[model samples]
Target: MNRPSLTWKLYIGAFYLFLFAPLLVVAVFAFNASPFPSPPWRGFTLEWFTGSGSIAGKPGVLVDPIWLESIGNSFRVAIPVALLAVLLGTVNAWVLERAEFRGKTFVAMMMLWPLVIPGVVLGISILAFFSRVANGLEDWLQTDLDFLRPGLPLVVLGQLSFILTIATLIIAARLRKFDRSLEEAAFDLGASRARVLRTVTLPFLKPALIGAGLVALLMSFENFNTTLMLVGSVAPLPITMYGQMREGASPAINAVSLLLMLGVGGIASVFALTSKAER
Candidate 1:
């Protein structure tokens, strides 16, 4: 193996430092034993991680109720969104790969357009469309529908619009390598189409499906820009963190952010390791 030159090593180190310096600083300040969480580093302490503080004369300290509520809401939204996206996306991928039809390419392109469109634009469009639809339904049916109210269902719908695209793409990439002859052989041996799919095709696609579902779940959980616009009165964890930072960044917020980052990083690492092991 060729040894990396001094200049190359320095460049690589600098790149990694640039990438992680802010995260390191945030982690450090999260444990700083100071009144203010910012500059002029003092001794290290873990009190902030468990204690509370008053913000703008509000009698709340340590773990903020609003922040915790938002985090719970985020999980509520993400879990359903991930499940729905995986089910819909996996079916879409299977149909696109297994069936031949006119306009198939056009349909695929339309499905993928969400991945290229800006998140803010997509959020606005979905909000507008839903608003119009809800209004029309109210007028025609003469009844109020609570589904359009700003809450879990709306959040899931907004996220699924884009996250399903990601799941579809990931599963589709793996499907491209699949052997159609396996299905053909199953059919030749008297297996029905549904039986072939359930036994043969789905088994082969399991790993990719799991990986894609996890990716979609993470993306939905961490989403900010789109979720912020569509969240209405309910805030997700990212939105809560943003609000906290805007008001006055506390060490607790930093601790929460670090914990979330570590959780996500750990899950991704495990997924990667398992994938490699399977290969």
Candidate 2:
């Protein structure tokens, strides 16, 4: 391969720095001794990361009651939602990529609709759909299911609406390049369809499945708009942090922000590296 010009290499380096400088600033401020998150560095301090103000001897955001509660709630919503979204997405990808059926194009298009739709619109639509469906079901079945009301469940569904679509596309991209003859060969060799899938197809799809799952999980954890609309009483980390910011949050928020940036950045980096390796 021909070496890139010095200008091109410099531009790539500059682009990366441009992208990551702000993140570096936030991570640095997380340890800033100052009360504010911005510049005017005030000596280093671990208090934000690990020190209980007044609560049980525990320390840091991990110990704060509100932060802990919100984090727990976020995990509660994110984990199951990720699992369910991945399951549905993997199945959808398989069906769309491998199956030949009437209206498959239409079905695939509908599956991808959420990707193009605005998150706010998707949230509002989900809320409306939940209400309408619940009302109709209550009328027909004569049972009022209060769980259908906006809350964590609704937030999960709202996030799932688009997250699943993303996961489907990610997995489908890998699936489209897959060789179908492998599955056929396995089947011809007396392997059951389930066995072929388990031993051949699933293993080949593992990286994409994992990448899509991590993406979905991260998206669910940090979701704001869709979760905001569907959340009734339960507050996830993002929503809680948003409220705190509105009230003029303290430096603790910087600590949280730094952690989130590191986490999301790490996930993205790993996915990118693995993708490059696969290619």
TM-score of every model versus the real structure: 0.89, 0.87
Prediction-by-prediction clash tally? 5, 1
Off by over 4 Å in 1: 1-8, 52-63
In angstroms, give how far residue 219 of model 2 lies from its true place. 1.3
Model number with the top lDDT: 2
Candidate 1 local distance difference test against the native: 0.81
lDDT, residue 51, model 1: 55
lDDT of 1 at 113: 89
RMSD of model 1 against the true structure: 2.9
| lDDT string, candidate 2, 143-180, tens digits | 98776888888889899988998999999999998899
The residue-by-residue lDDT of candidate 1 on 1-279, one tens digit each, is 399999999999999999999989878887777766688988877666555454323212246677678878988998898888888988898777877999999998899888888888887887788888989999999999767855667778888988998899888878878989998999999999899999998898888888888898899999886787787777888988898889986677777777788879987987797567546
lDDT of 2: 0.86
Q: What would the TM-score be for candidate 2 when compared with the true structure?
A: 0.87
Off by over 4 Å in 2: 1-18, 54-59, 138-144
